[model samples]
Target: MNSLIRYQVEDGLALITLARPPVNALGQTLRAAVLDACQRAASDASVRAIILHGDGKLFSAGADISEFGSAASFAAPSLPDLLSRLTQLDKPLIAALSGLALGGGLELALACGYRIGEPSLRLGLPEISLGLLPGAGGTQRLPRLIGVAPALDMMISGLPIDANRALELGLLDRLAASADTLVEAARAFALDLLGDLAPARPQTPFAEPAASVAEDFFQQYRQTHEPRWKNRLAPRLVLAAVEAACVLPLQAGLERELALFKQAEDSAQSAALRHLFFAEREAGRIPGIAEDIALRPVARVAVIGAGTMGGGIAMNFANAGIPVVVLEQKSEALERGLANVRRNYESSVSRGKLNAEQLEQRMQLLVGTLDYADIADADLVIEAVFEKLEIKQQVFRTLDEVCKPGAILASNTSSLDVDAIAAVTRRPQDVIGLHFFSPANVMRLLEVVRARETAPDVLATTLRLAKRIGKVAVVSGVCFGFIGNRMLEPYNREAHRLVLEGATPARVDGVLTDLGLNMGALTMTDLAGIDVNFLVRDSNRSAFADDASYYRVGDALYSLGRYGQKTGRGFYLYEGRQRRDDDEVVALAERLASELQVERRLIGDAEIHDRCLFMLINEGIQLLDEGIALRAGDIDLVWTNGYGFPAWVGGPLHYAEQLGLDKVLDGIHRYRDSLGTYGQRWFQPAPLLERLVAAGKTRIEKI
Candidate 1:
């Protein structure tokens, strides 16, 4: 018996157990062992049937993603070949599933003659998430077991279905009464099959669609889903593979699916998506913090200030079933803040995201307060007051006096120095920054800013708490704007500069939106309120280049009280949620250009795209070089999740790699030479970028 596989035969039944701990990922070694065990069972005269089960929690999560793009993935007896051999076995083959059976693991179960699962089973074909379709007979076999619609939904959505739903869809032959008896139930099922007490339920080539597929279903599916998956390759290919199963035979469909899978696997989109797949996991790793570090308990959280951000922050803990206290200086502000939280929860209930009971339950977890003493006992307290430095310092000093020892004090500051804020608190080791994006309860990204004296346990606890609250957390060293906003400075500068250089606000935004950003720069600023951005810029004015033209358009807009959507005008005129181009904003930009003695010139889309994105990429490289970001991948996670940077292109650094480091350097150099002093100051390539290109390297790894 192979070490990865355990084989045993008893009472005319051969049992094959996948012995890999954790998720039993179907790697090359495990595939070969499984094939060997099946061959032995076929040759043994005493074995009348065979049952396959995973030794622990999950049957398998999927193919071993670590082996992707490596020789081990394509070694002899690949997943497809092993599954094919299992289908050809003469004896009854049963798959006993518990926990998760995803991607190739589910494909393995589909290849078996019978599948018996525990009620806890979560089955899915989620290869599409990695920018690849299911290659190991999943696309071909899934539609045969269920119909075309449900199979396509499962593959495209990359979500798992519970065992009860799987049984309803005919994906499972039977579910065990309980998890503990899953294998025993599978053994009983195999004996029934061997003794001819139950009908043989062969699934591979013999399975048929549970219902007839509509002739126009494929076309309608494309029409409905194509817009959502624009610029994405894997989802389109998955639709084709599922459609092929409806018309073609199983063998032909399998071949077609493999071809599509290989095509998607080789594409740049898949490569980028795979980069993020690993990057999200890699972002949690802190170099100095050991994996075994004890974590601080965050049982009760407190948020100071009953403003928009504070209310949103409090909701995060409330939704996570943690008790939270909202502190405000005035009772009216506290009432308004709690009312906003209730309205947000009510909106969710109306949208069917929560039931009435869940809404009330979450609201019950939140407590309104007017006293700092009331929040002194909280395990964690986050200050979301005004963004001024002195104001934050005062709050920290007060917290230091009233808060219990070892209680964490976190700031929701976006660009302000966290180390300076920590200086106010005597327990600097307990102080950190948790920069939550606006509408914090809704956004997915959370920047866990580690201060200079931040203890390892606090950092670990915050990372864990971020997961508990359903946020994608990335650690960053203390710096202005940390990771996401720090890089956004240059990108936004270019957008504002481009508008001043005779590119209309619409034109500049349109170029970036066409490149796959969720929204244009100006549009995002407008939504976030231009006045807010203007204040942020003014607060960090000392960091700007010594030029009057920098962000002049935004400053002008703020001066005129045209505060984005709230004021009905800023970069664009807004009527409700719809925005229209305003001639006054364009005229204002032209006036600023004339006043600054800068010549106006038409900017093409290509220049606009290259300048904005390359500068963003350049700043990311600088962040990596300065050790503000731990790795190149961490920057990718910050941009993709926090900002509207397209996930399909990966993060800016990953996009730079795909665009070629040499080309990125050349673009920066071209602008630096062409734009005189301004370009010379801002467009000079980062030392790391220059080094990578000089070394003839195409990939951007950590400096």
Candidate 2:
């Protein structure tokens, strides 16, 4: 073995530690080193077994993300080859998994004959979320170890299961109760495996009936739960890979999985999702601000409203172990709000997600009262009341009156002026906008809107608070809808305009779905509830209809009282939440066109996608130009969080870059000249985009 592999004989067993630092990512260079180590152990006659482990807090964190999608490495036969070498080698290999065993890290363990883990260890295949799959035989090997159905759910969802779940699924051979015993237990398992004269685990050959059931179970599960996965390329491909394990030979299955991995990684979906994954890691940071921002601990949180958002926000805080107090207007309102909160908690309990004890514990922390006096000393107070100026003014006036002066006061205002929300209070410096998406506990994105008069500490506080409750907080300067909704204005406008021109609602949705959105543009409207969409439309109409044209589709639905899910009707009918295109809506489009004296012009899918998506991109550029968003990437983060902006699409601006800067500019101009001003705000390109276009730059990832 080369110098990278230390061939020390520990009682006739080989002890090979992966010396690469920082989670021992198995990039190309490290693969050669690992392969050499495995080969030397296999070749040595005295060595009966090998213990493979890492030096740091993790076994391995998969392939270095930096080398993810590239075609060729300077050295190494790819991640799959390295894993195959480990599995096929004569020496029985044991992996000591600690800290994080994810992606390629877990793949390595699967290749080994035996695996051991500590209680603190986390093992998962998170590639599906990044629009890639486990290329190193994770798909085939995992189901062979665990049952096919459980593996399908795990890999397809891309959510990490802890050590306990990993053990339940048979992913690990043995799990140590404590971290200290993990290595010893792993070594013992290795000895036991080496003692066996049976050959290494080859292709999985489960019984015939079980294999057939596995296929049926997986197919049914995908059809039932992820039928809408029509948009994402990875999920279906991952399902195919998992299915391959039951049929194909081990080596052929590995090859099939690798081909899918390479295909997904290079697909526009994977590139966009990977770009977003990196973008999110850097989203919270500001350039000039010190990396070590002293985050004040928000141990306890208080919400001024007990409405849906307020209750949801409280749940998020409580779920994170932070005590929450919900204050409402009157005794009746407080009681009703508290009831809603309890119902939410009980629902979780009924779902088996939480027990009665946990439900009670969380409910106990959520104290409800009519007075703001209870939360006067709270660390953070978020008001999630109605967006009405008067109602918000009253809440802030009361919050300022009773709450301790230093407590960060936040408003969950979607589009109201944060400056105005701040103006109602004496401590304007402490007031900020924590624009949590609806049902805050479920969403991952939080827009920390900074009012002009807000203090730097307050800005820092909301940013910190966002991360505390498990959200990607993007610092946004105050604007109508801040960043997410601001950009969405143009997107919906162009979608409506496309319908006006020649396409149907289904066609518009089709284009967006092909672009990788989870739902089509019209489908999203239906999902959000037509009434909810109408309310936003009316609000935007009152706010900017005079300056920019309002598409007539939304209000027309509102007039018919077809307000989406609640009414069981919308642009598309929702029959028990199964979305189907509405013929009535198509007729409405025709009627509206006739009323406006506009001829229906047939539009292509590309034009429909560009007009809708490019308008949003243009608006994002404007936000960047006006300094509403700190950087171009922040805008993308907001969209990924709040909107179903496909993480793979990398946000509107990133999509713009992918389409080519010149193309985006040309599309904007063409739409502007053809569609009028509401459509043309997009035609007026931002200086940064123009600069990039002039310089022939096509990617925002570099920035």
Candidate 3:
């Protein structure tokens, strides 16, 4: 096989270019080739210096994360081994970075004698996100070059810093004017280094922070970030590695980092997080869509509401530099929506996330009007209206009449059947569902609900547009609530049942929090408003006709006008955002249990956690078997991104696969036998689940 690294000689300099396609990931093959190239350069009599860069768009997007946990990761000329050799090279080595120098890529740059990068280059060590530390020399070398604080901040957060910030922090030696000039600049830098003829610094004994100060920062970081890092091992492990760098010698610190990296790589958390990372990427791929399918143009966008969801949706387009026309029936509503959008932009400006000029440019892209004609020229029209079926149909009818031919019409409905809405349009293929989560601009998840009649090009175009607007779009077949909310229904149902069966809302929430969820079920319910769920249940009465007790606690709370935090009471009492257990809600549950002659019993934490999680998992299986979800991982992406399902758990279906399908089936059987009718009604094993268990498959992929 040809080498992934290209070696050439020019002007007494060995030029090594990483020639891997796409993002130039540092896999075993690339590493070996790089090492061989370096060896060739070192042995060449004519070569005075070496200049390293990458072909195509990026220097590197970091290590080939797909190789994690595989034997190839530890193959000869491993990243650490190559970096060490580069550091010890007798000839000066210069790195020319253009696009991204992340994780192992940044470590490779740091190992060289001199580093020059394009001004727009993105650099960081983001292994913390995959539940691992930088296994090479990142943990040891970065602090030595840029000081302890900045290095710690970058590693702990896993966020990339721009080249300018990198230069300011001393991470980069110099910045070229543009990517086109990076190589020549690096060549000049290497020649300048040869003229100076200074001996290369030995890579060891990295700089350390004051012992007392380092201790304080780690402690403070753990305390402040503990909630976000709940049930996660990598952040703490990363901190430990960084601390070792502060206290130990370079080799010792690297050894400590390697040990921690191995531990994290083997961890369940790392496996789950890595699964989610791949799942998110897999969500965009449509199995049947042709690779060469032409995508519809979506230059002008229009939104058919000015409420919270509408305003947020409009902001996404405006942020992407696409002009948006927001239409409402009343001018007052339109004005309120425009004001909300302005306030959101101003808040971003206040946080230094955006400047006044950026805010103005974004706001300028938003056009609010009361006339439908204003939006006729829009290529995409999304209706973020109320969740009622009639309202959605009426909006679609109007959109069909007013929207120009080929205009993509979408609904941000959470529960209503998307096909029914599409049925009202003259061009059903143009109708799709772009279900953005609440605070659409901030949240990354967007469920692209593909209707039965939705054209391949429409699906392809919407998925592409979602990326342009900074959204993680997952394709979902037409179904009630699509993927996220459909699975969420069962989870919410079981949460209410658990409370009614004598578990406190706080206890249930606490268990879920411990299990790695950002918030507990009841806590999320309260935040979302109890009446919202009650309204959904009311609208879908036929689906729950067999079980009157379904979501009963929520309905009762809503009946009493205890809407949620906005009303100061629902599942729990809230006093100025502080939630406290309330006697009245508990009494209401007790009364309902007595009326139905349903004996209430104390529920353990494990039971509450399992019942809620398993039911959600069961629903996801049903979605998979019924073809509502394209793949198990896509369902995982929906939950992890849209529903706050812990990424560390790898979403519901993956979690079930990890738990063993046989074990999951056994639990469902046990629940069916114990709960009698209720269990039989809800715990029916999916055909796919039963078949997979029988086949002894441990992963959804095998199924």
For each candidate, the alpha-carbon lDDT, in order, equals 0.89, 0.79, 0.87
- How would you encode candidate 3's per-residue C-alpha lDDT over 1-703 as one tens digit per residue? 2468888899999999999999889999899888889989999999999898999878988899899989888888889888988888888788899999999999999898778889889999999888889999898888888777788889988999999998888778889988988888988887878788755543422355434254588778778888777778888888888888888888888888888889999998899889989887887779888868899999999999999999999999999999999999999999999999999999999999999999999999999999999999999999998889999999999988988999999999888889999998889989999999998889999999999899899999999999999999988888777888888888999899888889988899999888788789898988888888888778877887898775778888988999889999988888989989998988999999887666799898888878898888988988988888888998898888888888888888888988888888888888888986788788888888888888888877426
RMSD of each: 2.1, 3.6, 1.7
Per-residue CA lDDT of model 2 for 460-556, tens digit only, reads 7676667778999898888777888877777787777667666888899888877667777677776666677666666657666464334687778
Question: Per-residue lDDT for 338 in model 1?
Answer: 98
Worst 10 residues of 2 by lDDT: 201-210
User: What TM-score, to 2 decimals, does candidate 1 have?
Assistant: 0.95
TM-score of each: 0.95, 0.88, 0.97
N/CA/C clash count, model 2: 4
lDDT of 1 by residue, 81-174 (tens): 7888888888888999999999999999989888999988999999988888999999888888777778888999999999999999889989
Considering only N, C-alpha and C atoms within 3 Å, which residue pairs clash in candidate 3?
none
- Candidate 1 Cα RMSD after full superposition onto the native fold (Å): 2.1
lDDT of 1 at 590: 88
